[model samples]
Target: MAFSVDSTLKELLADERAREVLRKHLGDRSNDPRINMVLYLSLRTIASFPEAGISQEKLKAIDEDLRKL
Candidate 1:
């Protein structure tokens, strides 16, 4: 779960606009260890629920893919 969350966070962080926003909010310290930790933690805090309000079939498909991993 942590790896999945961290990977997702890494993807989000790779986006230029998202990185800029973090840089702005963290005041040029987004790369700092404490700030990175806080951001990663908050990413999980704000993440959508597992099912993400999707249909059962879609959820099942996602589950299947996750199981493959």
Candidate 2:
């Protein structure tokens, strides 16, 4: 399935290509144990959290990559 920032973490991560995009930007944090707790959250929602460290520019980049998939 096609992915976007609005897609839930579980939805995006289900696609290997989308997962790679996340891993590329988020690095090891993409695989953190705590990630399980937010599987239902959209990347957009997570990005809204200051602690998530995903800037608007980064979110756009991730969205672009997901669109390419």
Candidate 3:
């Protein structure tokens, strides 16, 4: 599957490369228990939440990495 910012968290997490990209950008937060609650949400949706701590720059970096996979 082609992964992008619009990809759901579950879809990204299902791919090891995508998971690594998320880990690189989000650190421990990528594995947080709360992540389960948003698995069905798109990266774009989650990034929109200020509490998610994902700045637009970070999201861009993540999108770039995901594209490489």
Candidate 4:
């Protein structure tokens, strides 16, 4: 799970479009705790959104993945 998370985040950062999308939110925070907090806050935001943009099952999977880590 750690590897998957690491690789996925790497992929996101490696892609120009995704990196551009995330650069403002990511800034210079490259540490684990900061990254984890970002993930938590992002999920919290998505979970509370009025419009159903993200699926509940996907959110559950993210929770499960974080628990595994």
Candidate 5:
């Protein structure tokens, strides 16, 4: 029952607001697979918590990679 990224994340991919935000940062790179993967994992991490001030070191790392892409 793993939420496999390829098939289970369709709702995240289909969300207009999510796409809009990613597009703002990524431009053409928004559609890149690596960029999407980081975003997907970041979203999963965020959803794991219910409070504010969550440390996002991993997301920061992902963003650094995103910048390289």
Candidate 6:
């Protein structure tokens, strides 16, 4: 089963430390959907371990995107 952004954010909110960290970055923003999207994409990119034929250039692009978030 896929772990979605809503589910993940729900889980994160349940943890004091996780919630604190998130609040630090997001402040009191009412934009849960956008925040959830950023968190979800960051987690997905970090979880990826691509195989051969996918060049280093592609990997760097992923890294840059994550850093921007």
Best by TM-score: 3
TM-score of each: 0.33, 0.89, 0.90, 0.33, 0.31, 0.34
* Cα lDDT tens digits for candidate 2, 1-69: 778998999999788888899989888576577889889999999999998999999999999998888
The true-versus-predicted C-alpha distance at residue 44 of model 4, in Å, is 2.8
Per-residue accuracy of model 6 over 1-69 as CA lDDT, tens digit each: 222222355555555654554455435443544555444343334234352223455545433433333
Per-residue lDDT for 1-69 in model 5, tens only?
A: 222212223444565554444354434354555545444454545434544222455445434443333
Q: What's the lDDT of the predicted structure labeled candidate 1?
A: 0.43
Looking at candidate 2, what is the lDDT of residue 54?
Answer: 97
Off by over 4 Å in 3: none
Provide the lDDT at 32 for model 2.
74
Q: What TM-score does model 6 achieve against the real structure?
A: 0.34
RMSD of each: 10.6, 1.2, 1.2, 9.8, 11.6, 10.9
Instruction: Output the TM-score of candidate 5.
Output: 0.31
User: Cα deviation in Å at residue 66, candidate 3?
Assistant: 0.5
User: What pairs collide in candidate 6?
Assistant: none
- lDDT-wise, the better of 2 and 3 is 3
Worst 10 residues of 5 by lDDT: 1-10
How much lDDT does candidate 2 score?
A: 0.89
Clashes of 6: 0
Candidate 1 TM-score over all chains jointly? 0.33
Would you list the C-alpha lDDT of every candidate in the order shown?
0.43, 0.89, 0.90, 0.45, 0.41, 0.43
